[model samples]
Target: MLAVIQSSIREYPLKPQHLLPLALATVLIGCAPSPDEELNATLPQLSLKELLPQAVANEYCNPKLDSDLLYGIGYQLYNDDKPEQARSCLIMAAPTHDRALCYLASIAEQDSSKDSAERDRQAFGYMAYSAVKNDSCAEFGMFQNFTYGMRGQTPDIDLGLRWLERSARHGDADAQQTLVRLHSNKGNLPLAYSWAKVLDDQAQIDALKQRMNPQQLSEGEQGFEQLSKIVTSKDAVRKEAREENIAVYSANIHMEYPETFKGLSVAERHALMEQAVATVSARPEFSTRGQFYAYVIIAQQAQLKQTGVDVLQNPQIVELLSDTELEVSEAVKKADVILGQAAL
Candidate 1:
């Protein structure tokens, strides 16, 4: 079964241009700029308040400043070693942004200034909120919180595993990877194979095959089929589409403006791109699903000198834009399919 799937999957091997020079790699890997230095170089010289206004701060889920931009800014600030600023922005974003809440939980957990009890309380609070919102990362965080026993909670391995499974079902790569290892370690080869198949970790799958008999492998294949449908359902597809859209847009922007992004870490670059996408998303003209697709298409065609006119010319885009009845999820699926085709 694994071999059959592997045969059909397209391999995207790394190209020569993808590799950094050995000297440059050494400098980046061993002697990268300090957080402060990176902050000064990459970010504009503006006060936090100027970048994020008090009015927006006061409003939870502010329409003027959307959650994505707030989270993006907060994420960048956190990466730049400015936890205080990150906390402020993340708090504002957390009402509607699960990832922001998860970040807040992490920030609280890592704060040396806080007492352990206080840290646990804050971390648990943020994680709980994010979990309610169905954020896979937060679900995984909750699993950790429960497994380790926080300030007000006792360790419950059963409950932790439940959360871990929930996170895996919600399409968290980390959670899926962890489940594969946990099950494999516990001699549950069938369960392990199911998750490994979902993750497309061919090496792990192959290793598990060596351990499992034919019956166990067949059961695993059945589990994989069931899990695939759940993970590839409409909600999951929309979640994946939104993430990929931001990632591709960000990568395109980085490619187009390498000088502006020089010396930035991958996380930092993605943070900046998130903010850029948020800004573009907030524009009135791009409010509709069709318009958003157009923006993404333009970004995708950055090196090709493709203009808005070219994007508008796309038949799928035209059809999508014309369909006023399409729900966001449907539109998202359509857009993702279009993007996948473009990639090919």
Candidate 2:
């Protein structure tokens, strides 16, 4: 019945006489719908997939222009596990929406096949374009690709640091946190504390403030409040990702393959560790992301324990054994020497 009325409405004549007859018929027959009702009734409660194009037509209308509606649809679709469809909305919005471009780049990176350098290049290009437009999320991504070399590139610490700083200035909490960790690691307590104050727990903030002079502490607090506005804004997709970093980043990173070298003899354990590291390091980009975290933290920790050394007392042992980027072969050799001496 709805379809028949819709067909009649679509095919209705354009003349005033025709509309007059329709109006009279609508008034005379109580069972019949007005033209507006016919059209509205045709619009059934369709799923997002069915409604998206119609919404695009209504809101976007032009193929060349970026649409906020399209950007939103793409973001939701991508989150909903529909990348193939999300690509459509995101690509349309990429002309103006940096977040959309970043998502497109990430999707390409995620969907790229083995030996697909062109695809990788395209993905990086998208990130570069988005980053140049001051997309904090894209800036952070580029920093990761260069710093960790986990996206088929060599690690360029200098370039990565520059981008990282840019990302932080743009109010990316991920970049801010990374900068804080890096500074603390390098013993640049002032710079670390300054940045950490902008992105830290109350305890960490208090500790950092204690390390600073009154003037520096005041400056740090002022800067923290200013950047905190950008960092905490819910509108930016990058901010959402930054909030998630606290819960998911460290927990999500794990060795691609198992480090099943435990319970084996020292030599056997050493060989297993070396093999795993070599295999992962040989790959330009990999699940391990250029880090041998599990081997050092878990497998090598066991060896250190067997030597009966207090891991807490020997800060040197902790420092030497805690490199994520250390080569597997080098790590095994170093561990044997250090743990062996500690046993004596």
Question: Which candidate leads the pack in TM-score?
Answer: 1
Candidate 1 lowest-lDDT run of ten:
1-10
Report the Cα lDDT for residue 21, model 2.
34
How does model 2 score by TM-score?
A: 0.45
Q: Taking the tens digit of each residue's C-alpha lDDT, what string does model 1 give over 18-113?
A: 121222243335656522233124212332233222423422223454455566566666666877777877777666566776777778878899
| Candidate 1: segments with Cα more than 4 A from true spot | 1-64, 150-152, 232-344
Tell me how candidate 1 scores on lDDT.
Answer: 0.59
Q: How accurate locally, in lDDT, is each candidate? A: 0.59, 0.53
Clashes of 1: 0
Q: Candidate 2: global Cα-lDDT?
A: 0.53
Q: Can you write out model 2's per-residue Cα lDDT over 1-344, one digit (the tens) per residue?
A: 00011111111112222232343345346555543344323223332232122223322123632254456556656777877667777776666566766777767767746356755766666776667666778778767766667456677765566566667766777677776666655545555666776665577777776677887667566555544544444346444553332112221221122233335554544454455455445644334422444333434455446653344345544455456567655655675566667668
- Each candidate: RMSD: 19.3, 23.2
C-alpha TM-scores of all predictions:
0.55, 0.45
